[model samples]
Target: MGYQAFYCCYKTDEVVSPEEACEMDLNIAGDRILELLQGDDDFFGLIDEHDTTLQFIRNGDLIWMEIPIPDQKGSFGKHIPIDEVGPLIAGLPSRIDLNDFSEMRFQSW
Candidate 1:
């Protein structure tokens, strides 16, 4: 079994999940994220079963991402150029997990 996650996109007007109504696949979710990033949507969120959250807030050409560290009191965040997320999107884990996103440069938020 794999870790389950939910794609919460307001721009898409729905949250994609692992069900007949909406299956949760990384590729599809990644595409939705890309769409949200490239479009006028201001927020994109992915939350895993463990309750760890990865959230993004888009502001103009920059995107601010926040990942709440498990077992910690604060969050780790980074401000990235919009184009910089494309590669990271391609390399996302089968499951959307904050730990899997540690390769990026992040600061305590």
Candidate 2:
């Protein structure tokens, strides 16, 4: 059996794995995204229960997400930019956007 990696977007009601979820302490995933957004804490701080969108950008392409904002309600993920990714995990953006590469043949998992 082969494990397949998929690029997925989730809404408020959707469920995700532990690894797929963002960290609350702004250490890992959350911190990475914050750096990409140029340290604009307002973007993350302004979020309320009504804001349910979280955007993820991999590579130079845009990924429109629909996941629920961790502690927020009724809010869905939205569009994020790739330039916001930091060097620590910059490759993740490219990996996630592998599907957009015309020269590469993607195999499931």
Candidate 3:
């Protein structure tokens, strides 16, 4: 299954579950974050997937990511922490001019 990411304005103490937050149309927010971090046209390619982790490659750099999946209440299946994934991506050699990805929509969760 494909997944999306999102940035939320709610407080950390708000107690909202990841599944609920994701359902709130946060893909736009996630996409915006990606745009700011990478660029308007940068493409993120999916590389790996596990029960709780996903890996993506952009410009040949690996990006590790974790998502918290709520228990059966929704599609949430597992929990992966970004801290575990970020470093893996940071260690890769940086490259330039990724695939032509203009006008691509960012995924949100």
Candidate 4:
């Protein structure tokens, strides 16, 4: 059990397919975030030890992310917003191609 959030990129309320919703680059960011959480035990030690899961799903302009934050004794979960996705990626020392992804739908949110 954890904080649940959904991000939709379309103007309509209709559910969209993963492929169609992915036109906004939400999938790319999700993959990168997972990779970061997995590849960096030193940086995200809590995530690695607690087995935190960050899932991303695109349905009709809606990007759903299920982040199951572990309920350890005194631990808490950090929610990453869609706008901050760019800053988070930029903060990384790795060479990731952050094209227009960051600028994709900042206004939508």
Candidate 5:
């Protein structure tokens, strides 16, 4: 199977349903997300067709990425430097697999 995913920005609700999410133009959402990083702990989430999820959590002054592990009902998280968000999102493709970011994750659940 090929990679497929949908996105949701808690503040904008840009993609609230599968029927319309359509691989959510990450380029646009990434930019929007970057701009949403205020002190509030807002969240941006990506859930693939397979039910795997990646959550971007905004903290006091930085961001953290949470990727779920379905098999163990656990998750892994990675701290994201505010300055590196642009480059990181820019390097991403429309579809992604968690395994590819193993080096950036640490067990969180």
Candidate 6:
């Protein structure tokens, strides 16, 4: 499979189920995360580990996560533009299906 990257948000308590988590409006939460990641160490540090197939960041009542898809036939992953993140996030559906965590794919190649 090709490389894919995902960005999502959910409650920090981990009590919320996938159904509830999907109901949290990822569009708004994603925007908050993007905004926070800008020139803010505290918000940036929410995500743990720089090197991994999966990484997560927690801030306040929200948690942000990323999953990178690697190129099966090659050693490198696809490239994604940084500028497209905001619009893609803002355009997310009101309800997201995070059960399998496959619905939100902002970048893949």
How close is every model to the real structure, measured as TM-score? 0.59, 0.25, 0.20, 0.24, 0.66, 0.29
lDDT per residue, candidate 2, 81-105, as tens digits?
5443333232333122323333422
Better of 2 and 4 by lDDT: 2
Tell me which of candidates 4 and 5 scores higher on TM-score. Answer: 5
The residue-by-residue lDDT of candidate 3 on 1-109, one tens digit each, is 2333323222232222234323222244334334323422222222212324222322223322322234533221222232333443333222211222232233335
List candidate 2 stretches off by more than 4 Å. 1-16, 19-25, 30-60, 69-75, 85-109
- The ten-residue window of minimal lDDT in model 1 covers 16-25
Segments in model 3 whose C-alpha atoms lie over 4 Å from true places: 10-17, 21-30, 34-49, 53-109
After superposing candidate 4 on the true structure, give the runs of residues whose Cα lies further than 4 Å from its correct spot.
1-47, 69-109
Model 2 local distance difference test score: 0.32
- Candidate 5 lowest-lDDT run of ten: 1-10
Local accuracy by lDDT, each model: 0.60, 0.32, 0.29, 0.31, 0.61, 0.36
Please list all clashing residue pairs in model 5, or write none if there are none.
Answer: none
Relative to the unseen true structure, what is the C-alpha lDDT of residue 37 in candidate 5, on a scale of 0 to 100? 57
The true-versus-predicted C-alpha distance at residue 61 of model 1, in Å, is: 0.5
The predicted structure with the larger lDDT, 4 or 5, is 5
Weakest ten-residue segment in model 3 by summed lDDT: 92-101
Winning candidate number (lDDT): 5
Residues 16-103, model 4: lDDT tens digits? 3322322223345434433333221111111111233334433322333333334433322233444444345334332222242343
> How displaced is residue 17 in candidate 5, in Å?
8.7
- What lDDT score is found at residue 11 in candidate 6? 31
Question: Which has the better lDDT: candidate 1, or candidate 4?
Answer: 1
- TM-score (C-alpha) between model 1 and the true structure: 0.59
> Poorest 10 consecutive residues of model 2 by lDDT?
1-10
The most accurate candidate by TM-score is 5
Model 1 off-target regions past 4 Å?
1-23, 38-41, 70-73, 94-109
**lDDT for each residue of candidate 1 in 1-109, tens digit (9 for 90 to 100):** 3234444456566554433123345566566666766544456665555555666767778887778675565677778887766555556664566566575555543
